[model samples]
Target: MGWFGRKRDPQDANEMLRQYNEAEAARLAGLSSGSNLAPTTVSASFSSAEFAVEDVFTITGRGQVVTGTVASGVIRVGDRIVVLRDGADVGSSEITGIEMFRKKATEAAAGTLAGLLLRGRVDVARGDVIRTSASA
Candidate 1:
């Protein structure tokens, strides 16, 4: 009987099976080649500091706070920073304070999840990137 009640040819079935087998063999060969399977090394240092924004809120008297992980480099209090969204510069501000787990700190390094208090109100939002100001 034909598949799905449609007429089927024996030659066509054989050809389809052969094509599938050839494709699978090629895929296996590519995987075994290991060209794309090589491990990549990542550098420990970054040229500039980058912080990914996960949350943003105002701290009333303290100013605005941006919380997230430091993607690269180091950030310190009083460092000039620029807000970026989709690779575009949104606004600039100064880091007035840094807090990790409610304890204040002078600086935050890469891979640290911290909250940074800005000196002034800059239009910032989630998914934005805070980077050390290049003009500073």
Candidate 2:
């Protein structure tokens, strides 16, 4: 974002990017105050690093499981949660917590490839796209 270099603060710049594109927030995603989202496609990954909070990164995941399964701790792309169990079609009674990477996710579009999950869950199968509930 050299063009937006003057935006100042990576978080602010990210917010500016969100204001520009203006993607819809997940109705059930439970966003925080003063949170804005912008949906755009780009490659992202995450890793452990010794840096300040300003240092940001991305993570991606893919899957083909039932939509309902995602809510049942399926660990989709851009989620920040821990993997307590590693099994397919696991029962909700066994799984615990909504695993995710970031508190506020931006641009969750359901498509062949998903971009942005901090930890990047390995279980997510291929060809699963988390899309916005909007018309193109």
Best by TM-score: 1
State each model's C-alpha RMSD to the native. Answer: 15.7, 16.0
Model 2, 1-136: lDDT tens digits are: 5775656545686677576444423432334343474222222222210100111232234321222112211233333322212222211111112222334333322221122333222333322222211111
Q: How many collisions between residues are there in candidate 2?
A: 20
How many clashes in each structure?
Answer: 0, 20
Off by over 4 Å in 1: 1-46
- The per-residue C-alpha lDDT of model 1 at residue 49 equals 86
TM-score of each: 0.65, 0.17
